[model samples]
Target: MSEVQELTKTKEKPLWYVVFTYHNAEKRVEEHINSLAKTEKYDGLIIKAEVPVQKRTVSRRGKIKEIEEKIFPGYVFVKAVMTPEVMAAIRRINGVAHFVGGGNEPVPITPEEVKRARIQDDLSEEFKAGDTVMITDGPFENFIGKIIKIEGRKINIALSLFDREMGIDFSPEQIMKIQ
Candidate 1:
């Protein structure tokens, strides 16, 4: 391997970063930042630094589909402490133009927010459209529905009124979700 490529492989991975403002520099910045990670091993502290990425598809006519990569671009996240040395090393890296939300001091990104961001970044699976649902949202405040039909926000439910089995049409707000 080339000397440069070999050097690249020795870099440490940092986790949990609050990278800010790479808005259009995801790819370039990853390479640049990772390279810097090696040139300056701030410490044995870097965890896993990365720019989260995901893909999406667009449907076309004739049932045709095309896949595309979505970039949250211009954001670099590093999973490391904000120690003077580590922060100094990160600042020295390319593509990391600034910290998240913008401020002079180093800001730590919360794990919860980061987890939610990572989880929602991609839609792995969709709701099964479960057997028709029934919910009563009006005067029939105590009513609920099974599987009927949903149009816009209107849901038709098969609810038992009094003691008679029947299908009632009502807004989801009027009904409560029950087993």
Candidate 2:
């Protein structure tokens, strides 16, 4: 027998695409998609699913609560090979509105876009009571104040204006620590 030539077919490459789901149902839709893919044995097509979220601190009645907020509401990012079977499987999941791109075709997002969408909290810096900070923006621009209270991004600062100490709220973007 002569030499035999074997022909092997390659599968489609996976790319990151954005999926639009019901409002406030990103987590649920992700779970459902994952469950469906697993049970239906389409795990190779649907590689990964994620919902970009950010930690936010909210203060109410003197109590501060840390909550995880989705960076993109009603949207979830999925990395997969967009095959007809994979698309059909995703459509069957509840709470899944449709892919971000119109029509049956879904568009892939750039890696840079994915990074930008993921809003991570920078916890390296900390401000405490009596710490001096400079107001960088807003009405208190160029003014110096002492930190009265620190609630995540919101800082309650006491500024001396006209010989009177007044407390004002400033976001992390509006203040820089001096000491």
Highest TM-score scorer: 2
* Tens-place lDDT digits, model 2, residues 66-146: 998888889988877788888887877778889988677989887578669872322223457888777767887868888
**Which residue pairs clash in candidate 2?**
none
lDDT of 1 by residue, 1-179 (tens): 86434433453222356666545766666666556555546434554466766666667785756564544556766655456677776676665677765566666666476665562321111101234332323565534446455554455566677888776666433443322
lDDT values for all models: 0.53, 0.73
What lDDT is obtained when candidate 2 is compared to the true structure?
0.73
Candidate 2: 10-residue stretch with minimal lDDT: 1-10
Instruction: Write down the TM-score for model 2.
Output: 0.58
